[model samples]
Target: MPITDEIKKTLTDPTPLYALAGAGDLAYEKLREVPGKVEALAADRQGAQEMATAKLHEAQGLLAGAPAKVTEAVTALPTDLKVLQERAQGFALQQVARAVELAVRAKETYDELAERGKVVVDKARPQADSTQADAAQAVEPSDAAEPVAEPADPAEPIEAELLDEPPAPKKSKPRKSAPGVTE
Candidate 1:
């Protein structure tokens, strides 16, 4: 008769069709439960994202205030300029040595960071170049492509002009050979 009556009849009958009907009903019930489950998962993900964003903002705020906090702490320390200068003078030599060491270390650190940055930039350069080339290709007509102006060479040497005055006279030096070393 109707589809519902047919399904009911098939469910009641002792046949493979009856098992199929039961399975279909179970599948339908599962399908009905899916929206609620998906909504719950989405809400959980949204809440996690919001929490992460809040924590990121808090960390940024703290980092932004760090310099001011450091300044305040340094100013609060109980030491006058004259006393500090005298104390510094007492350890002047040691301080100079330490300063030299720190300078060398900072130079090494800067060199390492520069090298790493160069490598990263080198890796990205080809991709950026290709993207620019693609854009250029898209914009230019095929017939005019051959005549497209080439980029000026970046390593062109500067033209030197002659100076009006002659260079200063070189000073003479008295040279002596080392006793044990040959030159």
Candidate 2:
């Protein structure tokens, strides 16, 4: 007979061997549930590991892009600053030239007025000497015959002259970057 048939026959007697065999069968049935539980736990553990690996890869991708992003940002700064510096220099030179021109023109004007005053003084001196001789020859000097006051100094009048030209308008610097560009 088969071993299963022999065991069944022995179990019918309700001896220690029959009790032990029945307990073994119960243990075997319980043992069978273990594989299903182990497979489920293994699947869950594998899923968790896969998720962690995916997250790690995502983090690494971002880290890898960081250098390139930093390089782009760094490169842009100098280019922007260079353009600004150039524009500033240009504006400074323009203002300096304008100021110098204004000063030179004012000096020329002063010199011309000084020359004209010298010419007037030269013409008036001889006339004044002749008038004084005529006054001494008169029998009596009247109040109207008193010498006229000398003309106001030409230098003083020129000094008082208002500035002929308005100051140059300030130059505005151009924007370094286009409107939508990121810094």
Q: Point out where model 2 deviates above 4 Å.
A: 1-81, 139-183
- Candidate 2: pairs in clash: none
lDDT of 1 by residue, 82-170 (tens): 98787779799888999999999977755555555555556777999999999998888598456633437747543332244577899
Model 2 has how many clashing residue pairs? 0
Indicate the worst ten consecutive residues by lDDT in candidate 2: 13-22
Q: How close is candidate 1 to the true structure, as a TM-score?
A: 0.31
lDDT of each: 0.75, 0.74
lDDT of 2 by residue, 52-105 (tens): 999999999999899999999988776677898998999999999999999999
TM-score: which candidate is best? 1
Clashes of each: 0, 0
